[model samples]
Target chain A: MTETVEGLSINLATVRQQWGFAEAVEGCLRHGIHAIAPWRDQIAAIGLDQAARIVREEGLQVTGLCRGGFFPASDAAGRRAAIDDNRRAVEEAAALRADCLVLVVGGLPAGSRDIAGARAMVVEGIAAVLPDAVAAGVPLAIEPLHPMYAADRACVNTLSQALDICDALDPPQTGALGVALDVYHCWWDPELEAQALRAGPKRLMAHHICDWLVPTRDMLTDRGMMGDGVIDLPAIRRMVEAGGFSGPQEVEIFSAEHWWKKPGDEVLATCVERFRTVC
Target chain B: MTETVEGLSINLATVRQQWGFAEAVEGCLRHGIHAIAPWRDQIAAIGLDQAARIVREEGLQVTGLCRGGFFPASDAAGRRAAIDDNRRAVEEAAALRADCLVLVVGGLPAGSRDIAGARAMVVEGIAAVLPDAVAAGVPLAIEPLHPMYAADRACVNTLSQALDICDALDPPQTGALGVALDVYHCWWDPELEAQALRAGPKRLMAHHICDWLVPTRDMLTDRGMMGDGVIDLPAIRRMVEAGGFSGPQEVEIFSAEHWWKKPGDEVLATCVERFRTVC
Candidate 1:
């Protein structure tokens, strides 16, 4: 449980290019990884029933469904539509029996600079969809992205900010609303340890790991694999564990130029090796 | 004073490619800009004595000396060497009679993964030079770079973290240490307004203005002109004002592809125009 790869989970984005939903599962299974976090596209590729069947048949643990938050919009109608889409995503996460639906709560609307407004919309959208998520028995995991993604990808860009939202929406420290703490997005933060401690075990829903490359080529897809970059993985892993979240350290690299270019087996093999040694 | 260009200052890096020290000073003067911040290289190019003479003769108000901190280093000798260089930079800043010596406190050292250790080095390095800075009567302005630069640029990535250092080093609010708050580096922060309030008048040494472009091209360079990007300039200016600092809002853009390509006069003209209108 403490910086051990025994609980390693692959957030399928790590080897997304080399394998589809079923194929990726096989790859994880081959590497003795029983836990995975798959994106919506992967679920859609193979029908929802088939994806669910695979989960049941293989007895694999779906750590999280990636993801379900783009709440901000230009207007009320658009906002309503986003909430509806989020509800469907919650349903899908439920079908997949995902532990939580990770929310990459979106950034500013197109041609808009009102980040506060966007953030409010994110809160409202999440609140609007909270009922559906609760009814479906699917916990919501707010995944605060890297601040670089603050403009276009996600408004929630810190563990503190995500935990604030969770506190507002589900103040009881219920497992209903929590945070997916990704070291790649948060290792630079000075307040990270304090925020992780504040989140504790109950609100600490998922633990994602990836390295932040020094000369990060592309903002969205240039994530480094474990031990490949500058993140103090063991340090963050220790912090997460101390926070009392004994969840799997989900490897979620989005390295389009590097890891994605490798074969699925090679990627999984490397992940396993790194999981044992570095992470 | 209220988001007006009447107190506008331009950092020379905005048009570094277009002009040398003397030429840039002449260009700024021609645009009715009486204030500027020049980098060390620019000062070194034209002898420091000549540069200081030019500054005095033109009656130019230097808002800040363009940077004096890259403190983190691999070993004791390396760190000691950095502290010595910073002492020299403090001397230069005092020679220029600048308001503050802006410190872009360094990131992780070469082949190092200890961000906490790097941060400790930053603190120790700053503490090492604090007495010299005080003697020189040059306040050390900690310019917390954007988080994206945390690995290779600067570890101090938040106003709060910088302020903590300030509190630790200069607890009496002696104005010996403070922050150069840049909109481009900090616009995405949710705690910006609150932290600005915390900085108040004494610790807010310099106000830097630039825009955060939607697709920030290069992490180091692709900065936008004030009106060209998505920052809420007026709102931040107001927050800074409310925090008790009514200093000149310095224009500092690092647009390698766009603004840097323009003529010095043209860049100065546009900065003047944008300063009056948008910033």
Candidate 2:
């Protein structure tokens, strides 16, 4: 299929506040959207079997599980906990038959100034959980967040850095590990297009779509809708397609005060419209 | 002269809310510190010629001017106005016998999200004014801001990006253009040490120091003083020194609520104390 983005999926975080998992899924189906990426919390709320059954019954493609990262901590015990959680997440992805488990590699450890050290912890944590993920047949996709999140959110904040970690851990360029390229996080990077090309096929995993809002009000939540913001979507999509990534451009807006307040059906319809026209 | 931090200067914007330029100078002199950097507004308020004379009379070194960036705008007239104002800033730097004109390359033009294009505009803006700066012996210090400011502040957000621009414009690695490596901006980067090393002596125009607060309250203004936040100053300073940068670590905090409320002399004294112990 040429994939004109009409077949594009929406990550339910785009309308998280308006609907629970079941409601959001129903909303997607109502709008002729048949694929989605759901956050872990959403899956838990709907129950794993039900969520999985919904997918099988409706033939909805589970593009990716919302997360399976945050792999950094102050101590071994905390890191082990993260790893354990990641294992569970991988199992969930397997149950849902998700395309991949997206990872948001964590930021600095508590009371620590060493970002490099935190990064090391992330690597070690991922290595600890890699076997479990591989056993579950769930692909792990490291999502590089915006650099602003380096302190509190995820330190893997560039496509190059995330790909570097993937290369380090999966040296033979195995399909087990890859990167989830999000346009909002990397739209400003000068080496972005080059890095996307470097990602190639085996290492290119999931693609998330959102726009970077100018004068962003909240550091964490104020994400603009696809066409409303300044990202050249077609331009980035072209780069990804050239890299042979034909997956969904999952609409993963973290807009707490905007889209979250709209009707779920309305939000899904808008996402579909934007995906067809702008994305 | 083995330039220990005893020779390191403090840019009072780090503490300007706490002190005027005159008071800051007096305080630095009290601490046996003889070098400082001041913002343009401070000079305007205290009178520019008088600010120049104070530096001459007190034998204080003005390491570099605080700023002269903000290149992107909604329209050509606005951009032209910014460039014209930048030319004036270069003149002011020359007048003060400052070492360089620090440029915080501006972010997206209003209502636009093309960061690559914004970066292009920055290079063009600098090229437009480079001749005047060169003629006046004022090197342009490209201060790559933290990525958090990519939307409203400077879009040049990494040492490598800044160095790339410098390479493009000043291919010979001349003293005409370089970078102001603030530890806060580049600390999270895995490539920081290498990039700083790559910057080398000639291209290392300025070295601004401040701690990266963990919470980082407000995106624009909430900077922490040395030892009060999480960045390992001595480690980065080691990298800069290893890279052959022999300039003073100019303290440049932008704490709107904290240091801004303290007495001018107290803030200067704290800066000196922090410089001795932490920086």
Candidate 3:
């Protein structure tokens, strides 16, 4: 009989402070979590070859690679370098057999106030990488980060905006480009449900799960666990499912003060419990 | 000869830490700023009658009232109380002959995770008060706060969203139901220019100015002065002006640690200087 952890994927960042790539894989196995999304740095620490070996041997599912975007740069050379790096990211995701390569398309360039210009650079950068991504058989998932990160993190801050990019690039919903919809980033949007429906299964490449704490202390690392915050995880899940995405809900918390300090086992166990209950 | 501070208004909250309503007015005058926006608490501290007297005597242009909208409530009684409070706010704005009454619509009620419900409550709440607002001749400016405040402060987080509400309530683009376009709250919106154009002069009740700091220390307070951060203020001003709003750009910085600690004169002087230059 094949043992499978259905509908749950632990994003390695959830226990980043407590475990390395190998340790996290082991921890997830112990908790019966058979799927995961991992950051590039985590893959590098274990070596891409070793990570791929582990995934293959254990029959583990790589939900999505953490990222490959940050395309905005002040100079052409810098922008070219970003595109080159993104191509490498595509190779890694292809190696891991990831569902998609998640893209956190970058925010404003240094000393630049032209957000529209920055956004244009993101689209151009993504287009440059799309051919490489398609050739590698790795779908690119544009993760629309929370608007608060619009200044320093990602310029693409809405599902509607991400879909617009996908339509611009792919045009035919070819599954070559899609969006990684995280509840934390998108739950507050009034058009979220409509956008999710518009994305459907074809464009909804990944479904990331996390909560938005009421008094979110740190913008970068204060994300809440499944049931701890204001986000209605089950409701968001329903919307994604209605949109035809029946994939594992990836748990991607970046809690610097709380979850990061806990034991890796404890974190995995909590995620499993929440996945079964609240999520 | 009559003197007017053209294209400038000091939201008293900028100098709130150092001056009360009366003193803030004096400080603005000292800096040659004739227009001002004051919070309800500041007006209460000096008595509304007294505040009105000062506004009348000094020939001050009351640009806007600080706030008047916290409509979401778990129970009908609580919601009713909010509506009553909003009515009082309308009366206060009327008494002061202010340009508009800015509404920071409430977020989710306690222990509630339904943002959609909260949003519905916001529209209903606004609709409930529209009659009172119209009766008092006090235009209600629905200020779409940043998405960071969507969970606690305001659910309306986009110009498009706010305009949708305005269209729902008053489809004819009446000046009574409009929006206060604050750069600090809305500078990141993808459709800002389009929405500004949609708002035009009639729906653009007020124009607010401030900057967004990159590594924002606090979600509530750490707003930057005009030139201190990444927002393209002059570009935004041009958009607003193109939309036909040529009102004084109200400077509303909520920098608790920085501007709040400065002397009132210095804060006002800085506001004037930045307003003239960066803004």
Candidate 4:
């Protein structure tokens, strides 16, 4: 029963525990979801050419290639290595014809407490990969992670901060650099609305949806489905839409204990139902 | 060995697992720490009069009361109850002659996703208790919890947001309404330095210190000791000091797994050692 659902996408990580690349895509198709965002490892597993072939043949909308950023390092060699890897990610994103190459910029260097230094490295790393991304016709979407992940994941923890990076690098709003707004990471931000408005259509690249569970069991993977947690999804969606992004709202959940243990078919069905009603 | 430490104050919660109010005070005194912050329950357990007597007799500087804010409620009656309780907290602070009545303004109302509404409720609740606080000569210090706790603990999640509330309620930068800056909650903020500068001395009521451990085991009670985590404590202290706040740097740790299970004397010794060296 494949009935196309508009303005809806599934981030493969949501059902990562239940299915592989091919299986997840098949599951999404079964659920009438045509848009998707796939992690680099998943793409690697199926081979990028095969993934691209599948994407092209099925006419699937590759919302984003997740991800390519870990800029900060203890040394210059490590930084250069990260930039080199990001460039490869850009090429893969280009092959997939994705809307953007999501960048979860790295946090503080190993055993280092200097967040400012890490941020500077992120900018430099992005600048290094900008030309490659531009040549490949891929936009770099800086996904600012939640502040809880400031120590290890992504140091860019606010939309304002991400936008500031964009404004600094791509002053003309060329769409080469933008931000991925995830409600799970950004719903609590005081400046969310203002920052969304500031992002506008040109810089607001992607909109990811997931609920913030009240007791959030695991910091890494304890996301709740839409309508299951406390995030005001419609409100955030309104903010993103108002900012000019008319893209599919990508469902990205990383529930290690609950959803991950469920069957892929059930997860997809639930996502579709929730997307239709709550989201 | 009671050589008084001039600028170190202990928030009794660091030793909450091992000692109650009087014993915690005695522990602090033994460590040559003459200042302490006590939770309302701790004060109540020891009888407020007796707690006040101990502070007065021992010449212990009550740095700040542990808390007095949980504004947002599902109903108007609940909000009124919170305000009434805050008034009592003000009286208690006044009796203790503490520096300020720290307010951990609460999060979303049950079954509701209205963060803005919760924040508004916080402001209204604070306003309702402001007159009593002023009359009792107990300054209100709004402590913004980390964004992770924005769901169940506090909706006010940034120094900028807390300051905005203070500014709206008391435009004159009155010492009566201020912010309690905690490194654990705000170390990742990009506007931290700017906000600290903006707070200056008048608006900066309390300075709480603790480390943000990597792989934080529990969101509520897994804080690290001074030198154990990645937080740049000295750098943060420099910012606060530059903001014209020369008050004691109050050590507050909620380590359920590690520090809480240790001996109170060991924790005090480690705190003093870390405060002198790392902080």
Candidate 5:
């Protein structure tokens, strides 16, 4: 049973408002959660070297880096800038010895209606940064956000679409490029099961667990805890495991009105409880 | 130019609060827009008979009826009740001589986690109502709402998924069943163009036009006017046209903060101008 709890990981954004990177690690450790995923902003706050040092000193298992994508832009210069930024993210993930660098590949560029063009840039951006990721021995996990984010946050909005990109870039089922399946984003997809099967072990890199609130008050920040919302966490987790991923199930809730207001220790404890019984 | 205007239609919900059924039709006529789609509430407010008389008297084209779906329920009685209401809606659509009866099929029933079960109910509900729709000579246009509404508004959230339902119920390409292709709902779908082609002339029943705002303020009512958002109106129209749907490009904007507060005539005028210039 403790081994099952050991497989649980906390995404720092779940307690981001309450604690910085180092404090969040301490909080997770107190709750007996040794695995974590941190957002780039959180790492930047403590400085990458300090964050990496803390991870090494604590012997923490870095599940995945929060993000490294947003590739779309209105012009060639902006696209190049995104690619360069992604390369830096690859180096940072490698420095942390993280399992994978997750990508929330961007949506339509500002004042641009070209979703297809944005998607094209996402492919180009990932391809451009693939060499850096390969050199650093860091995997890239394309996190397909829910369809609601299609317009402004991510054009890659399905497991199938993410797999299509992987097939295009790393066709031989290489562990170099893969997907970070977030249940909150994909629980509603009718094709989820089939696509999960298609993703199979090598391509399915990270498994994120969160719930979809019934009356989702806010589009971005109103994510529910594992058992609180409508997602069948065990069911999705079963599919994920069947597809060959045995990594820690990272909890990544972004509830602005409720959970974020709680104390960091309480939040970590609740995550641990939910991870055991519900997840 | 008048011929193009003849192909333009207004969904009365765009100015629903400002005008009743008759007034909205009169407003559409004054704007040189001969076609209009009315919701059930608007139709019932002024009495459907009177609304039908106005449509008949003015020779106004009833492009499509607003809705007729919400089939899932916790109990058998509730499911049966929904089917009965849908039958009544078919009768209403028949009375108005609308080209098709649009179905914004309901989402998950209360406290239900089984989206697949909810989807099965939708298919069964549509099948139950198919005979009445066929009898009334009203085609059932399954409008696949955007995936954001998958939880509460409509489970059928993709053109392909809707077409799959249509295929199951009316396999012969019988005009009795088809899809109401709404750009606002499907513009983000990467497979949209291909699926529109799949819907082709026979099954492409209706084409709905609206823009997706860059920063959509609300999930239900923050829709932009035709050219005000990021949707490539001309591009989607071209796909719909190529798919063999020569129906009016119905402008359905649920802009609570913007257009709905305006006068009905002003809303209709803007619809005309945007329809001409952008759509």
Candidate 6:
């Protein structure tokens, strides 16, 4: 493990299988990794108060909360429920003093096939929660998932697409909206460097890093650790820097087979090592 | 079957496992399928002469050849080999009088991280072979694979990207260069409709259709049949048709688990049924 890991954050989901919120906080703290992001389920699993106490007591920087966006639905009631849930997520981000609420804008709803409609729902959903997020002082970061996930995970599948929403919802480069650029989700984008540069500082809220495996066995998990796969991390980092984003490069991996099965401390240690050398 | 599909073409890949080239052709013929797009490997297996003779004897409109590009390489020598191979593919396409020789432009070369560089090689490779293809009266249809294949199978992963290559190689709107727009590869693209509009008439060489399974078990082999997954096929077909591509919607399923295991006759029957009803 690296002796120092400044400017790097460990998103708890990277080692989610081995550790819960509190345990992950302790594990990262043991590895000199303070900044972290937790999913709502993780927070809920440990109770918000305890999770907050860990953050407060350890003086860990909450890079961003894992999520709060599944905007598309089949009907008005479903939309209302999504918005209400987003509001709760906004409150959670506020409570945790998170850098932003990372929004995995959802894909087409069940029994529906209109991607444009799902995208419209995402825009409306983000707009519905913008004021609350602004009031809570928690920025919203729309994480454009990879196109493979477009049908089920997120319809907004490109950085340019996310920026379009950011533009539509918050026109003046308002601080309340931005993007969480995850390399695993978007490393293959030809316009990635350009889009990241277009994001600029105000809109580039978070940067996530993980390698894309060549034979990605599973669509959702099976993410490779840094340096173990094909992504040119430093090149993307150069693009991010050129784009004017100089924030924590959070290590957010979902390796259901490899890292998830390792010991939490070992996983944290490897993340530290990879972030220092590869990411 | 709803009995409305007279123009649907069954790409032999949809039922690759159930039959060899001749068998698939016979099966398609039995079901009144007058069109097919056989993979180069399958054609080679039956001997190109036999395949071409069958096409001539039966008078089939081979909508498009299955493939002819994997241009990226670590060195110039390898690239030259790719060009030479493409020339051979062009000849085969000519032999079969296929509408176009589809190009799945290559991804990064082995141990290489520069996708942009790899893409440059693809463009250059295409430029080198464009003359031969044009001379043979075989249109070169650049078929962009999904982004998941960007690292290994294809770096050209969007219709816009493919169209960009076509425009660069054939700026005069020449009929020799065009795109084989596959809904499975490009359905997630936000600029899909606009790109289709951009690729009007002569530039739109072919249209490939297959559903993106909700859980695509294998990234390369688990493609679903039309109407079986999340893609809105009729909508994309509408856009392509509006763009002046009156080509048959070619079925190109690669489902190792499902379709590949089905009887070729049943699969062709299913394709005809889906073509009339769902597609």
Candidate 4 per-residue lDDT, tens place, B92-161, comes to: 9999999999999999999999999999999999999998888889999999999999999899999999
- Model 1 achieves a DockQ score of 0.76
Worst 10 residues of 3 chain B by lDDT: B1-10
All candidates: CA RMSD in angstroms? 2.6, 2.8, 1.4, 0.6, 1.6, 1.7
lDDT of 2 by residue, A1-279 (tens): 222335578898888898888888887877777789999999999899999999889888988998888878888889989999999999999999999999988888788877788889889988888888889888899999888888888988899999888888999887999998988888877788899999998878888898877667787888988888878889999999898898777888988888888888777778888888888
Q: Which candidate should be chosen as best, given lDDT against the real structure?
A: 4
The positional error of residue B100 in candidate 2, measured at the CA in angstroms, is 0.9
Rank list by DockQ: 4, 3, 6, 1, 5, 2
Q: List the residue pairs that clash in candidate 5.
A: none
What's the TM-score of each model vs. the native? 0.97, 0.95, 0.98, 0.99, 0.98, 0.98
Q: Which 10 residues in a row give candidate 2 chain B its minimum summed lDDT?
A: B1-10
Lowest summed lDDT across 10 adjacent residues in model 2 chain A is found at: A1-10
Error of 2 at B259 (Å): 1.9
Candidate 6: misplaced stretches above 4 Å? Answer: A1-4, B1-5
| Native contacts, share recovered per candidate | 0.67, 0.74, 0.79, 0.88, 0.60, 0.70
Lowest lDDT sum, 10 consecutive residues, model 6 chain B, at B1-10
Order candidates by lDDT, high to low. Answer: 4, 3, 1, 5, 6, 2
Interface DockQ of each model: 0.76, 0.66, 0.86, 0.91, 0.74, 0.81
**Where does candidate 4 stray beyond 4 Å?**
none
Candidate closest to the true structure, highest TM-score: 4
The digit string of per-residue lDDT tens for model 6 on A42-124 reads 99999998888888887889999989999899899999999999999999999899999999989889978899999999999
TM-score of chain A in every predicted structure: 0.97, 0.96, 0.98, 0.99, 0.98, 0.98
In Å, what is the interface RMSD of model 6? 0.8
Task: Estimate how well candidate 3 is docked, as a DockQ score.
Answer: 0.86
CA shift of B201, model 6, Å: 0.6
The models' CA-based lDDT, in order, is 0.92, 0.86, 0.93, 0.95, 0.91, 0.91
Taking the tens digit of each residue's C-alpha lDDT, what string does model 5 give over A37-153? Answer: 999999999999999999999899999998899999999999999999999999899999999999999999988888889999999999999988999999999999988899888
